[model samples]
Target chain A: MNANSKTENRALASTVLELDVNNHAGVMSHVVGMFSRRAYNVEGIVCMPVGYEKNGLKSSGETSSEISRIWLLVNEDARLEQMIKQIEKLEDVLSLRRHGAEHEVFERLEEFFH
Target chain B: MAANSISNQKEMFMTSKRSEILTGAQIVVRLLERQGVRLLSGIPGGAILPIYDALSQSTQIHHVLARHEQGAGFIAQGIARASGEVAVCMASSGPGATNLLTAIADAKLDSIPLVAITGQVPKSMIGTDAFQEVDTYGLTIPITKHNFLVGSAEELLEVIPHAFRLAASGRPGPVLVDIPKDVQNQSIEVSDWPAPGASDPAPAPDAVLISRAAAMINGAARPILYLGGGVVHSGASGSAVALAEKAGLPSVMTLMALGAMPVDHPLSLGMLGMHGARCTNLALDECDLLIAVGARFDDRATGKVAAFCSQAKIIHIDIDPSELDKIKTAHVGIAGDVKAVLGQLVPQVEAILRKPWLARVADLKATHPLRMPGIDDPRMPYGLIRAVADCLDDEATISTDVGQHQMWVAQAYPLRRPRQWLTSGGLGTMGFGLPAAIGAALAEPQRTVVCFTGDGSILMNVQEFATAAEEVANVKVVLMNNASLGLVFQQQTMFYGERIFASKFRGMPDFIKVAEGFGWQTLDLDNAGDPSSALRAALSLPGPVLIHASIDRHEQVLPMVAPGAANKDMIGG
Candidate 1:
């Protein structure tokens, strides 16, 4: 995957596109490919399986026991809106949430590193 | 005590009467049979031998052995795209699985439903970087709708059904299942048969949004219905025409939605965006209400995003919710199946007398009609497309490899039925035509299947020529050889100050000799003296025939809206 260009960060605000996708092997690749295919770079990505304790949670009728939440960080632009639409179209992606710069996940990570 | 009871319950479930003793390979074959698959394409190899051994005993399915796994993947895609059902492809570990990647990615981009099954090295040897072991799961992640690396035979049973469901369900795409070699040989009691993949219901459109859209349609002086690929996916072509005719709005067909409405419809603004007709783009710019259906405002479709429809109030209708405000924010967004939403919304929209708007559209058409070079020259790409389209059936499935030839087919082919024009619009995959044409022919044996290809694109999978002949597919190959990557050459000439790079080939193999070598009857258009007589003979051939039409490299696809330029500002008009 190509690293996000530094020039994209020169904007005043960056938005984090948080997606809830089915916990399957290819979900992350599809999401990243959608962005890269359009030349839209994702600066930061954090993806993990939601639950490991309960492997037999099949009574709810869900196919997989785990789900993945991926946060994509990028500077906001007019193209970002369209990118989100394409991302939301992914079959594995269940839901999406948009976070402004005020979202603490990235800020906290910066502080912890310091 | 609790742990003991849990183990006891699990043992009981495993030994139930409904269970049958079967090898892992038998389970795989049985699952595919249950999914209603009748045909498959693949090559046999070491890792997948167990499954093939089991497959030999099954009479329910027929497997067409393709020369390459990539060809097999495309054969499956052809079936899926033609039948609107899940198609299956199989391969072994390592290179066999890797070769299938291109077709899988092609299916993903085109939204064709396919399930690719592959054999993996033993589970224990997976991460040690064992011989013939590749990270199949890791490598396939981005290209598939979903993928599974089954840990056991029991998991295999669970994953197969879901894999079919994911591939065939909402926004259909390719899915993959990689099973280890040992798992295929393992025998187990079938404890239970899992339920078939669940069917997803088309989402109901929000009533309020529909009403708002109807109001916009009723109030607007100038409106245009922009159709996209989703319309074909949803089988909403009838609804698309109904909405347009009822509201009396001009409709601009996107590249993917070419046949959604008849090409001759009075209000039809023939293909819109980059290589779109100047009249269509002008009508789009002037419209006050832009009703976008099943189409994303892709960069190719929207020349300059900011100025695409500056004066228009957008109403985006799509099954995929994210597409609602993805490009141009919809003034009224309907997130539901295009057919269902349009079904309800069409009746609510008041009919209008948009005489002035229609007149403006007509005027644009009269003033700046799409012009083709060498209308009388049969050697030209556009002229060849027209000649072939005339010779084929209206319901014929036409697939094209990516390049200048693809754009010409999109522009000139007289498409009469929805889902009849298949091309790599999203990812623009070269080498897609021959394999896809094979797939299409296999799916609908009665319909004529034609593949329009370029020299550069066809060479990408030129070996598939054998697969076409081997399958005895009724596919005709119209090889338009420019001896160079024509699209790239055009781009370089127009944009990059004409510093020609490696786009041209000095010592290319003679395509006719290669086609004949592949056991296909070859015809050189230049040698025939009369193009029409040669085309007639080629089209009437029994099996796969190649019509090699060589043209000058300088010929370019015209009416190009340059990147970042407004739709109205076009060169080569």
Candidate 2:
């Protein structure tokens, strides 16, 4: 429970979550609810639409005509593989992969300072 | 598929359910329900009678009638914060939407998931100066995450889901959906709900940069982990602690990153900036490198941006690309979540510790030390706050209103992780503490909320006292009452000419009496040297509890570098 943990003995863990889905009606709540029910910590969730529909019924293809993608930064050691599998099984989810659970983040200070 | 036939079909669908005329309000409710809205918090008003009537008939959805439209917006925000869901609130046109502006800005700054539905004048009457017509969309764009104005119900299904997705996705924020009177009365069957499913988010850090960041950290002897709200949102508290522990780094958190690490951690510096901990400011001034995560360099956080951490080699990790290079200069910045980035860098930093830098920082900590009085110290508020910190969980959600009391909490209390401490950091909104606490409590019902507010701050929205009672939220209210507008008095004393303009509040209301009136268990602490007993009592109480404590009137949040001054130009107590 250390300062990162709820108590004095355990230490809080961190993880990275990659969202893989094709459409908007994807069962996002299912994966989120699973995480919530399991007491998982969420850091940041970012998503963007990449692919447009082949039919081209939509105008500029802004609002996810083809595929929707997202990026999640979550608390780690959260049984990431199991979480990914569960997310992949959700209705609109096309795939799930874990890329950097074993890595660290590096950045530039000058790039951030205007 | 044919254009003319499709237009005709759409026009026919807009007629109504039974081919009868419907009021604007009825159309609004149906469109809202079609968008899968379960509950809406708002008040009844003169211009929105039609919508309320429609809401009354819709059994699938629920409406929470608020005493004021402001409270309604706050309640919706509460739901969003707790559930990570887009909560809806509504008001009539004009004053209704205006009342929601404060909460909208609140949600906008804090990035809460919220949707505000408001009424507008009929299409023909618009700009012709119709009654109850206000340019809500125009007033909202600058503040809202996104906004929409619907003239017809044909745009209902198309706009509703789009609003929710925008509010809930990306860096979540508030969205406004205003439907005019004629639009709500119309009806159209939206054939297909847009099925852009919720996609998985990228949790990976830029592995390529991890070595570079670690090298920078290793190269610098004195480094500070400037944790931001993104750490909490990223759920990277563990990684943060690991990296800090491994690197033997001292850490300071922004208001939003208050709870990213446990308060009791040896290297943990509670909060940074304006009302930040003195020790934290000292650490920032001396540190040569800053590891920032999910933490934007907000003006409030940076004081005067130019002089803030001017010399530090900053490694900023964030997800929003636009936030990069926004305020302060960054030597090394990564656009990603703190959790993933920290995950990548933790192992890399293991081999690269600057022993000299660590030793120098230790030397600094020993040389210019932070003083801590016992929980029973004569600085009554300080002692009580410390005791409360001792009693509560490291992960407990803490909220505060804007005032001297807030500054005190930011200084005294220890936050262990992000998202655990919520406050009006950017806006410095006064009435925000209580309502925000209520909202936080509602959002994460399983967790407890401790709200630190000033005597002046609590009164801004005392109506929420009853809200706490009615909602039965697990909330603990600590009212640091100094019998005056404490912060205002302090500011006037310091900034103003000390002529005492409206700073001295007279005929103060007895807050204990007021708390009891709202069905909250009340405790009066003229000098609560040790707040343990009160905290225990407040926690042990079945429902919500309020503790009113008095503090020094002239207490200024110390260790201050006035705006635009170098961080080294600090005013230490």
Candidate 3:
């Protein structure tokens, strides 16, 4: 059985959905609102624009990597699989990757903060 | 200082070819008219004055001045729900934008297509928290389908179309656009307006999954087709019935899908879940296969998720890919449009008459008939709903507020067509009735619109009564005055050892007087010697009318499965 299979296990584990979306004003709302509307909980979220932008040197249309990377930490239930599929369908989302509980992006952040 | 940022952003973002030079407010007005927006509802303030000034010059759009921002949003929802088209509402900064939150959340929960436009403080003042300034984009982020904070006039041109497209497209919901005041004042050149993108057609169903679902249907001895709101949104009621009839399968409707299948149909299991018929819940428990079509297994519908349809080998089909296998892992998951998928699957499966299974279903239904308390007495809420249902045509749309009255309507109202029944199912929002009814009435001017509201729910958005009267909307407010938050009171009674504190309203306002104050024709059901005559007279009134119904506080929504209990473990008769 695949590790993601619901049949083999019902054990709850946290999963992260990493998404790259077009950097824009409304994109994050679409990502966050879908979860809230469905009553699904997001344990942690980290998002930031890719490439250099602190100096305001690049125009919005000119930058090739005008993309924002979003990491959503959620319980790896059957619902997460479906949520990932929906997130992929969003027009602004360019690509997505699902990481199992072993992924330590949020944990690493915690360690850095400490 | 706030105005400088808008100018700075405008200079940086003038990439589009300049064809015409006009103020940002004028562009907004022109864009709305070009997009075929005939009606809008809002209350203008200092930040939005320029837009309103431009709006006043236009003859194409009629703006309704709502008493509250929430009323405006719900009115837009009503229009969208009734018309199956995008609707718009507007508000200014701070409290005005905050007031619209409840309605926006309601729209999000029920998947209503709405676009809310809010005016913000000048861009520099956004973070500074100037007078009447609030971060509308931040506040509404969790409640909207998408939200835009327009930085410049050029951005406003792009954001408006995107807002409409996002609001109307795929599993539709509310979207918001927050415009800085200076952005609306500054002149910008625009070549042409981008048209809102049309909704993309649902992807074709997988051939392999279709066959798998067909095989499951053919093999199962007892199968049930569970339908929800997505079926209605996709206009797939005919296909839903076709599949059910072809396979000789019983069907169950959720609160949002009450009218997807006609209640009088022979194989219909009226509704399933907390307030569901006992037979329907039992049928679900016994079902060998649960073919969930456009139906998310919501907690209210599923009771305890693990025990719900435990025996069923599920075949889930939905337009939204996310809905499939979300709650219950399906044996065969087909991610496609309900209509197209049903069209593909119905022909592949052979028709079978499951005589024994259907007979058992009939027996269960007979054994646990839906009993009403004093149903013959018009004084009861149940009787009032029955009386109203009798008077209204099938074409009439019924919008309801959340509470005991909403549940009573779900149980007793024989909704005949999809889109005719509008209720806040997912969000369960109170105070949604009057404003939604106004939108519904305006959307379908020829058809009658009725709002079923409770004493507690009406108080949440009582300000909407003025809007209903001012618009002269073809709506009737059937206020079931139980003098308490009936559902909360019921829950407290059952689970909290009858400890009712905040739920009761000892000195509720006279609904008749309130309706009269709002310029509506009023009818008091309690005082009328012949209530049927009074009801008929109220229905015949030319303008907005309020039928004040006096009901007992003891009346409860029956057949309620306790929290986290199995569907079969219902408490009331």
- By DockQ rank, best first, the candidates go 3, 1, 2
What DockQ does every candidate get?
Answer: 0.29, 0.02, 0.30
Please give the lDDT score at residue B183 for candidate 2: 73
Q: Could you tell me the TM-score of candidate 1?
A: 0.87
Model 1 Cα lDDT, one tens digit per residue, A1-114 = 234555545553688878877776557778888778778777778776676343321222245556767887887777887787777766567889998877877776786668
Sorted by TM-score (best first), the order is: 3, 1, 2
Q: List the residue pairs that clash in candidate 3.
A: none
**Top of the candidates by DockQ:** 3
Model 2 residue runs over 4 Å out of place are A1-114, B1-40, B46-62, B196-211, B352-354, B372-374, B377-379, B527-535
Q: Write out the backbone clash pairs for model 1.
A: A26-B141, A29-B142, A82-B326, A85-B322
Cα TM-score per model: 0.87, 0.74, 0.89
Best-first order by lDDT: 3, 1, 2
Candidate 1 residue spans exceeding 4 A from truth: A1-114, B1-18
Q: Which 10-residue window of candidate 3 chain B scores lowest in summed lDDT?
A: B9-18
Q: What lDDT tens digits, residue by residue, belong to model 2 across residues B1-573?
A: 699999988887765433544454565566567666776688777666667878889998866666667778877876666455678888888999899899898888877778898888776787877777798877776567667777566556556766777776656678888877777766554444444313237546667777789898877777888887667655688899899988878888787777678766877766777656555676787778888887888766777766677678888788765565656556776766666778778887855455675666567567655544444652466776786777777657788888877876776777655566777666677787777777677667777888888878888878878777887868888887777788778767777778678877788887888889988887776645455665666665666898777777866666665666655566664
Q: What is the TM-score of chain B in candidate 3?
A: 0.95
